[model samples]
Target: MTISCNPKLIACHDCDLLQSLPDGEQRRGKACCARCGAVLHRYSRDSIDRSLALALTGLVLFLVSNLLPFLALNAQGRIQDSSLLSSSLILWQEGNTFLGMLVFATTFLFPLSSLLAILYLLLPLRLGQRPRFSIHVFRYLQSTEPWGMLEIFMLATLVAVVKLGDIATVIAGPAMYAFALLILVLAALSASLDPQLIWRRLDPRCNH
Candidate 1:
């Protein structure tokens, strides 16, 4: 007789307790740790496909958000429209170089990098192929998520709009809507992603 250990074992990140995961189909709800009540996993159906779609959508929206005018101000019969890149550049030209770069990184660079990284990781996985530097790309995605700041930037933009409305006629632009949608889509994508699943798929033993 031969004894075999279950291959679906997972160790809790919080408590480091080793346990076996249920079959994929059985994990409809969140799996919790027996020792510490930590959430071990939340199985999302077709997560890679969903995340890929969202990442692609977010990329398009991101482009529109950067290219089009975010807002237009009509004051004293003069109109001025500001795009994201122009705004950052204006800040830089005004000698707020540090603030400008910070805005650029948080608003534009990090979010774009995250979307590209997601696509790089998920697209290959969806096609039943492995991406090069998969672990590094996934880790980059995780680290960049905190710095995306689209939601925070949008909130600040809304506040500015309200304040400026009293002084000038403020018109919201198409880019604003695209940016808002991008934020929601990115949030959903993040939620839909299962790091454990990706890690498992990336494992050579599991792949074989």
Candidate 2:
């Protein structure tokens, strides 16, 4: 059957083949492209609700990760604790302005913006109200999603701890755990979000 030019229609990213989405019942199974076997889309169960919950949880964890001590170092009878924001400021104060700003943007600003954007879009929809500029906002979220570098930052933190372990005692802080959890939560939030479903809900023209 021919697929209508509706929201339910999708183009395969791999082969650029256009295809219609299966019905709700057929969607319960895997939906693959007929020409290339590339997966088109899988209906995310409770896409909106799951994304909303994950985004809220991610926001809380993001706050905790930035506000609390990320790690503590003890050497020569002196202890130093560093939070995420403090680390960025320290970098800036050390004259590494570009690096500092990059760290702050990738680690702090982008991630926070992503979470907030998710909430901003999903909250109104959850309440049965359409948000203004939602299409633009959602596009912004998609574009900036790649810039969130929490997982990379976490890896760098662990490496720093390892390299410093030879000369000092490294103690994991509450924020470290929270940061780790935030990474996972943000990943889940991204996965749970269905852009097609969101766009369809936001624009009634998709239904026609």
- The prediction achieving the highest lDDT against the true structure is 1
Q: Across residues 97-203, which tens digit of lDDT does each residue of candidate 2 receive?
A: 99999988998899899889999999999988888998888989989988989899888988999999999999999998999998899778777788877877877
Candidate 2: list runs displaced more than 4 Å.
1-4, 24-39, 204-208
Clashes of each: 0, 0
Please report, as a residue range, the 10-residue window in candidate 2 with the lowest summed lDDT: 1-10
TM-score of 1: 0.87
Write model 1 residue lDDT over 28-90, tens digit each, in one string: 778899999999888898889998999999999999998888899999999998987776788
* Candidate 1 lDDT (Cα, 0 to 1): 0.87
On TM-score, the leading prediction is: 2
Instruction: Write down the RMSD of candidate 2 (Cα, Å).
Output: 2.6
Clashing pairs in 1: none
The positional error of residue 68 in candidate 1, measured at the CA in angstroms, is 1.2
**How many collisions between residues are there in candidate 2?**
0
lDDT of 1 at 140: 85
